[model samples]
Each structure stands twice: as C-alpha cells, then as structure tokens.
Target: MSDGPTHGAKSFRLPISGRLLVISVPYFWLLLFLLLPMLIVLEISFSEARIGIPPYQPILQFVENRYLEIKLNFGNYNYLFTDDIYVSAYFNSVKVAFFSTILCLLIGYPMAYGIARSEPGQRTVLLMMVIMPFWTSFLIRIYAWIGILKENGIFNNLLLAVGLIHQPIAILNTPAAVYIGMVYGYLPFMILPLYTNLEKLDGSLLEAAADLGARPWKTFLEVTLPLSMPGVLAGSLLVFIPACGEYVIPSLLGGPNTYMIGTQIAGEFFLNHDWPVASAVAIALLVILLLPIVWYQRLEARNRGGAG
Candidate 1:
C-alpha cells in the first residue's frame, strides 16, 4: 500500500512538472524577448530627449546624499496629442488599416470559400498557390509592386496597348497604391483562416437549409456566413494588426499624403533623433492595437459563458 501511494505521487508530479516545464518555456521566451523589449521602450518613453549616444536622458540617476532620483517626463506623451502631425498620422494609419481589412475580407472571403468547396486534391494545389508568394522575400514582392504600379509600368503599358487610356495614370506614391500593396501582401493572411473555418463547416447543415427551400444565397447568409464569423474575425485581426504598423509598403508605395504612424515613428527616431517621443508614439500605438485583442477576448469569454 505504501509503495502504491508513492508510485502514484511520483506519476502525478512527473506529468504536472512536465506540463509546467513546457508552459514555462514559452512564457520565459516571451518575458525575455517581448516583455523585456516592451519594458525598455516604456522606460524610454518616460525619459527626456538628449544629444547623447543613446539620444535620450536616463530616467534613473543618483542624487546628493546617495539618494536615488527617478525623473519621468510625461511631456513625451503630451507632445503626441499636441502635435497635429502625430494625431493625423495615427488617424491615417487607422483609416488605411480599416479600409484595407474590409477590402481583404471582401476579396479573400470568396477565394477562401471557393477553395474550401473545391475537391480535396484541388484544395492542396490552390492553397499552395496562395502560400507560394510567402516563399519569396517580402521586400522583393513589394518591390515587384513598385514595378507593376509605376506610371510607365506593366499596368499602364497594358492599359495603353488595349486603348483603354490616353496616357499612364499616376498610381505609384498614392493612397491607392498603398491600398493595392496592403491587399496584395495580406490577402493570404485573410484567406487561410477563412478557408480553415469554412472547410470545417457541417455539410449536413447546408443541405438541411437547402431542403428547407432556402435559396443558395439565402442559405449562405443564414448558415455559411454565421458559421464563418470566427474566421472573419481572425483574418481581420491578422490583416489589421500588421497593416496598422506597416512601414515598408507605405514608404515605398505611398506618398506624403498617406503618412502613417510607422512613418512617423521612424522619422521621430531617425530624422529628429527624438527617442522619447518615438517611444511614446510606439507605446500609444501598442495600446491602441491591444484594445481590439482585449475586446475580442472578452467577447469570446462572454460567448463561452453564455454557452456554458
């Protein structure tokens, strides 16, 4: 009896400890990489801008009588609100991300639905085509867009050869170009999640709807659309979050009028050498991005509670 109890205790502890060890690895990795970097940025956001090697005044310093002094500059955050450039950039970034997400959803949903409904062998081939773009360098892909959207580029050449227009339209360095690049780059992010969700949909429910005299479109609205909501939300988040902070696409494809938060952060850090202000802007943007995730999590939790 004593041996049995000891063996049971060892087995119980082994799995518990193993589970904790596995969980702790990722938590520790996040703490080391994500949390530590964020804390550093948060610390920098509270410091003053300076012309030193670090380009920012340290917040912690030893004072007279061996006293430690902690100086926090709220001015960095205040400057963000006071400056119209930062304010405008924030709004513009959000606007671009919002519209781009909507466009992706519109385009990707159909593609995803089609793929999900295809034969199993065709599904793999279609998915490979969708994912093949990722095998190429992201920068190279964006650069390819530059060639395609330029005034005298392939797009305009095609239009001209077809007698569609008198001259090449100005697309490069415009908001339209930005939208094109965003949609092109992030389309896969939207499609994969939607396909995953739509593929797992119950065929029986769809058939049941059809038997109930629902038209295909009506059945889709009442059955398919409702079931695909999770995919829609996931894909939107995947697109929106990265698009909001996109720098390279905007810098390459978008004009001054399309100024975004990412551009603002870079300019602050590099051009102006204002580390505090840049850090503050970054932190503020992080907070804005986190809000949506927090809301989604709460909504998910509430839904689960209701179901329970």
Candidate 2:
C-alpha cells in the first residue's frame, strides 16, 4: 500500500498565505477606519484654530528655503484643564455614566437571570422582547419618550386620572429624563451579556450548594455571582463607554443645564469653531475611557493566570 492511500479525502486546511490574509483583513480594516481617523484627529489637536475652510492651522508646512516646519500647540491640552466648563463636564459625564451603569446592572441582572432560567421555547420569546426595541429607529424611540415624559403627557395624565398628584411633574428636558433614556436605551446591552454568561452556568454547582445546606440567596451569592462577574464587567463597559460620550440622549432629553463631555465637545467644535480644543477634549475623553478597558484586560489576565 502507498504511504498516501486515500483517494476520497478532502483537505480543508488553509495555506499559510491564506491564514495571513485572513488575519490581515481585520488589521487592514482597523488601520483604515480607526487608526487613520484617530491619527488625523491627533494631528488636528496639535494644530491651532484658524479662520479657514478647514477651520484650523496646519501643524506641518514647508517653510522658507524648502525647510520642513512643525508647530504644535500644547495650549489645546492646557485649555481643557484651565477651563472650568470642560473640567466640570468631564466630572459630570463620568458621574452620569457611573450611575447609569449601576442602574442598568440592577435592572438587567434579574431580567437576564430569569431569561437564562426560562424554558427553551419561552427563552426565545423573552429574548426577542428584550431586543425588540432595536428593530425600531433609536431616534424615533427617544422622540417617543418626549411625548410620554412631557409635563402633560401620558404619565401625568394617568396620574391625574387616578388623583395621585395635584400637578404635572416636570420630567422632560431634565437630568431625570436623561437617566431614564440612558437606562432604557442601554438596558439590552447589560441584559445580553449577563444572559450569555448566566446561561452557561452549571446547574450541578447550584445543586451541590443546595446539598451542602446553602439557602437559595446564599447559594447565589457564593456560587452564581462570582462566576457571572465577567458578564457584569462586560455589560458595565458596554453601557458605561457609550453613556460617557452620549450625545443624542443628553441633547434630546437633558436640559440646557446638563453638562456633559459630549455637549461640551459639540459646542467647541460647532459653535465655537475651535477644532483643536474639541480634538484635545476628545483625546482626553478617549484616555479616560481607555483606563477602564486596560483595567478589565489586566483583571481578565489575572483570572486566567489564577485558573491556570
């Protein structure tokens, strides 16, 4: 018999070149869409604000005698610290995002747990309900809330019909409205991750805990919560990251007094026509957000190391 005797064999292996190409696709995409745009923004941040079509002075130019000249404005970064508005906006954005993350966790955990523990047929229907809002336009959904939360809107009308309150409460165009919108919009993000993690949990662990005389709540605290931490962190990040830089929700539902980094950045870029300052603020926001991501990675690494 020949060393290679099989005549009906089908090879599914990719060549080295093919593997490299597959890997490089995502790298190429990141370079094009993410890195390149960031590099442009970074370059703009180093430039000075100027009255022009582009609205900023170039950092790099060919000067007299064909010499390359570079002018970097460190004031852009300093301006963010010096300005009270920017400083306050940063703090407020972080505060809102933190609270929103907490609220989402509180609300989503139970919903996710229920979904995870549901019958297989029912799980699909429940999951569909959780994600159903996504089928509609996000803008439309936010706009719909405007009708519901307005002073004389559906909520107040119902309350008045039941004589629950003497007057209509001012909920629209307020921080309360912003929080409600944030929670409503980002709840799915929290739920999906928690459900994914919880669904994979071993039933035997719970059974063992029960056999060892642990109560339901005690078993959940000792066994379930610890195991579901990855999902918690993942969901928190998913909600917190966008909530920090949230422009639409704040702009629509939040009042003029609502100070957030998104609104501040928008003002600098559009109203003030200060591109460099806006870019600097954006870079600072990116740095702030990057810290949590780095921390999460290190935590995951530590968990893996301990497990190993």
Residue 27 error, candidate 2, Å: 4.5
User: Which residue pairs clash within candidate 1?
Assistant: none
Candidate 2, residue 204: Cα displacement in angstroms equals 1.5
| C-alpha lDDT values of all predictions | 0.92, 0.91
Q: What does the lDDT read for residue 113 in candidate 1? A: 99
> Clash totals for all models, in order?
0, 0
For model 1, the stretches where C-alpha displacement exceeds 4 angstroms are: 1-29, 295-308
Task: Give the top-scoring candidate (TM-score).
Answer: 1
lDDT of 2 by residue, 1-308 (tens): 22243422422266769868998999999999999999999999989998988999999999986998999999999988988888899999999999999999999999999999999999999999988987778898988899999999999899989999989999998999999999999999999989988998999999999999999999999999999999999899889988999998999999999989998899898899999999999999999999887876776676466555
Q: How many times do residue backbones clash in model 2?
A: 0
Tens-digit lDDT track for model 1 on 1-308? Answer: 23467777676655787978988999999999999999999999999988889999899999986988999999999999989898999999999999999999999999999999999999999999999997778889999988999999999999999999999999999999999999999999999989988998999999999999999999999999999998899889888989999999999999877789998899988899998999999999999899877766775676466545
Q: What TM-scores do the predictions have?
A: 0.89, 0.88
Show the lowest summed lDDT stretch of 10 residues, model 2. 1-10
Model 2 clashing residue pairs (backbone): none
